[model samples]
Target: MKSEYKANSITLAGAIAMGTGVMIGAGIFALTGQIAQLAGPLFPLSFIAGALVTAFSAYTYVKMSNAYPSAGGIAMILQKAYGPTTIAAAAALLMALSMVINESLVARTFATYLLEGMGLKRTGWAVPALGVGLIVFSYFINAAGNRSVGLFSIVMAILKVGGIALFGAAALWAGGVSFEAATDGQSTQIGGFVASVALSILAFKGFTTITNSGAEVTDPNRNVGRAIIASIGICVIVYLLVAFAVGSSLTLEEIIAAKDYALAEAAGPTLGRTGFYLTVLLAIVATSSGLIASIFAVSRMLAMLTDMKLIPHSHFGMKGAIRDHTLIYTVVIAGFLTVFFDLSRIASLGAFFYLVMDIIIHWGVFRHLRHEIGAAGAVLVTAITLDIVVLSAFAVLKWQSDPLIVVISLVLMAAVFAFERFYLRHLRDGDAHHDSHAKT
Candidate 1:
């Protein structure tokens, strides 16, 4: 019934706003400095490269949606390709978990910038407390309804996009930024560029949230693909401008030094205290909107999984549909993640899980259902190949730089499959019992 409530409510612009809100919220504010660290003065180029890679990844989801648009999004694709098997269920679960991880990342980003704007130090429970508060706020807003989510996304998307443009324009007018330092005429390593691309890919990964909400969008069959493409285009341009503004205003060292709050830091030089407040306000808007849209999408996805019997569900004495339970579950998990992990680890974990799940989706489309979905074999192969190369590079880098999160990602992925296997066994046993009872 709640699913029915959302049907045909989201317009094309709303869909684009949802996708843009998620991608921009997740990436630009938090990742500009981290990307600059890896890509040097050419950090903007990393976003360009990332946009290209994201297009390739988007191709499969778009093609699949064109053929079979469902609210199930990734899970629906997996079931279509693999026929409700363990692989489909596991990959779907992985996607759901990655989305939850993304929510935590956005929430933390909100806390970080909010504290920076307030001129408060980030220490002990303060950051997580603020992060959890944001998540809680988003949860309440999301629980209101899909229409509320869509309208909020549009408003925030407009405000944040405008805010970013103003930040860039005002900073450029300040005129002290050195593009020479951005390039510095240094020969950067191809590996470092590739690693940055991998992270940059994470920044645009929010586009998939559109696909997750496919069933809710008006004219989803056609609009889902369009929304995905439009969201990516809008975000790519915004990210490039922001990257340049940050790069020009701050030295590579400065960017890295304040990587957690680079956008706000960039404001300090150009717009003075007023600009700093504005940039921080923009971050709050983006991250808050992102958390709202993400919670809406992921809750629907988990509810779909439960409805399909791929995942078990319990009401826990709640009143509404399965989505209500899933919403609570999603927020609880994300809150725990926010409280425990810092920004970098939260981001790395999200990227790792998403890339792996993305590879799985591409493989499913290419190997099992290419003909049915009207997907190009060549495009799917290219997408899968690039995901593997970048994901491998990212993994190696993470293994060296911060191995603990890598371990957590692998262990969690393994646990998803293991749990699915046991669930499948139970399903088979229950069916056998029903068959015996009918015979009797």
Candidate 2:
């Protein structure tokens, strides 16, 4: 198998492009209508709230990255704080799995919009078939290596970001620039609104992808943090603009009605049928780029886990490298999820896995790595507090709305922990060489 990391393969611009590529790709297109459904008319604010919460969560990662930039990233941070134990491996796996879930969510979103634009029926095999095809397409792009991925991400990010911004601005202007959503008579459950932040957080969680690629980024220590912040900053603006655009063009009920293809639906009202198609086209570009960038990071994260011995690795007769094998693994799982799970379940599962893993990361930094990593205790504490509140709200809301997904998420997490506990037992006290220099 090939070595894990190739330092300086990604430059700062490429890093930011990849970061925003994943964020806006999955964030605005995939979650807007879903967030609207849960947060009611004021769902736009959930993006702001999610951003604020994410900024807090980012503090721990930024500090850790600056001090010790590595390809392993989140796993590295977990190991530093908790050692080579089950919790560390499990949490890192959670993060990786959550990202994989995001990939399927994005793939399905692409399929959903493509079908809508093609004037095809919203149901049947076409959606999943197309989604899986895109996942395969992305694997080829990623397999082209870092330069191809980086250049493609940068170009696509520019096109999609510009196109999406124009869509939002035009929709708002055509709809007569109004905050009518704020005067909505609808009364949504506060727990549901708070729960919406979980999805919004999922939107912003692409920032973690930057950390996973930190070792490959030029000027890793500085650029990784900068890229994370820049990506979030761009996404916050884009999400708010799009949220208001959708709110202005469509009523709360209308957005929820067309929740799967909210942007296309919104475009039809103000920008005409042509605009609707354009938005659909843009969504395809956004999701395609998002998957490519996401696949790059997820494969690397899994490869890093293998290199760290946090997870088992097998060549499986893959000719090139560990990363080569992991790339196939990432897309295959994403495609399976794309086929098996619907969009809502995929999003819900992602939110649960990600929030739980995030909470563990914050706790580790706060309880053990703060002094060593120079992370502020207050920020870490606030991050943990927010994650718990959002996660709890999400769980209760899911139980009330769709109990099956909640049960599935809980069971999967428990299963991961149990598997890790058993796997690490064979590691001779679980003191992975990667964690011997680590603290707690």
Candidate 3:
């Protein structure tokens, strides 16, 4: 049978959109209050620290993509470092599970902001309904193709960044511009600071998605690397400026006190009712954009896995009745989970998976490309080490709060690896049989 693989054609702009859109989402709007409560006045510094950590991981991704430049992005890197079966199973489970949770969180947050804007007295059903609708819409857009989703992402990213900038500037103009307050009241202990910084890093987790579609990018080697660096740089500046504005504009108590819409609440004091409404609208758009990007990336990852024969061919080769039925099944599975979970829990789990992927990619670079080391490699290595240390500390703190969830995540990852090993042995046997038949 002839192969049905289609080449990816993503430009630098589209790649940047994928990275930036994933990084800047409802988290920026909502996390400020919680982070402020945790880090006190040094929340801006936490944002900077998170950006730096992400920049380190992004550097490794860029270097690896430049060297291998395959369409599967991280999966390709994993295959080269680990092998096809490991790449397929780990990548599939990680991306699928994280995206399902991430999409649901974004949808719930979007509905919350939307309902709050319209003064709806009750939003119980609307939240889940909006989440389901967003997922269905995103899945369809992604199914249409990468270009369509990429274009939509670029537009949405612009709006999201613009909304953040406007909100920041307006807050600053209203006498909420002070760097001192961001970390002023927070604990000055190094351990506490690092823990807060790690959580803040969660806010910047989506930038790595650019490499996930390495095969589809127009110039995977050059553009993917360039886009990852450029997006992180831009994200850093935006996060800092926005954090400064939000921290300075309202007291930590006011921010923490806000429940439904923190950014809207912060803006309300500065831009009044108009600013509040605008922030809410921007949140909806940002979250929706994120949902679309997640769906697009995860679907492409599925396609890549199919091409590599990590997943069943039927997954990538649905046609007519099979295709329609598959779509229905995917929507049903994704929708049910999104409706049942809280956004923070989903985000935390997604962050954990991403951290693991980041570590794996870094190890791949260190293992396979030692001869190609340079100043960038040194920096990348340092960043990865620091990231691991930070993540470990954060995990310990989180474990202290909820040991069961952390333990379960570890078990889940281990089970995924075990399944990959079993499937790989079967694949090897099948290949041997095929070779024997050909010889006869």
Which candidate ranks first by lDDT, i.e. highest?
2
TM-score comparison, 1 vs 3, better candidate: 1
Predicted structure with the largest TM-score when compared to the true one = 1
lDDT of 1: 0.85
Task: Report the lDDT tens digits of candidate 3 across residue range 237-330.
Answer: 7887777777776766666676346777777767888888988888888988888777666655555565666654453455643323344455
Task: List TM-scores for all candidates, in order.
Answer: 0.95, 0.94, 0.87
Better of 2 and 3 by lDDT: 2
Q: lDDT by residue for model 2 over 1-440, one digit each (tens)?
A: 23546888888988887777778876788799899999988999999999999999998899999888987789999999899999999999999999999999999999999899989996779889999999999999898887788677789988877889899999998997675565668876788889999999988998888887788899888989999999899989888989999988888888888999999999998999999999999999899888888898889889888888899887887798888999999999999999999999999999999999999999988888799877778888899999999999999989999999999999999999998888888776556654875854
Name the lDDT value of residue 292 in candidate 3: 79
Candidate 2 residues lying further than 4 Å off, grouped into runs, are: 1-4, 429-440
Model 3 residue 412 CA deviation in Å: 2.1
Of 1 and 2, the candidate ahead on lDDT is 2
Model 1: per-residue lDDT, tens digit, 1-440? 34354688778988887788778775888888787777776888999988988899999999988788777788888898888788889999998998899899888899999998998999888989999999999899988887798677888888877788778877877844565336655555677778788789989988887787787788888999999999999888888778888878887788888998999998988889988998898898888888988888888888889988899888878898788889999999999999999988988888888888899989988889998877889999999888888888778878888899899989989999999989988998999999999999
Off by over 4 Å in 1: 1-7, 180-187
Instruction: Give Cα distance to truth, residue 49, candidate 3, Å.
Output: 0.6
Candidates sorted on lDDT, descending: 2, 1, 3
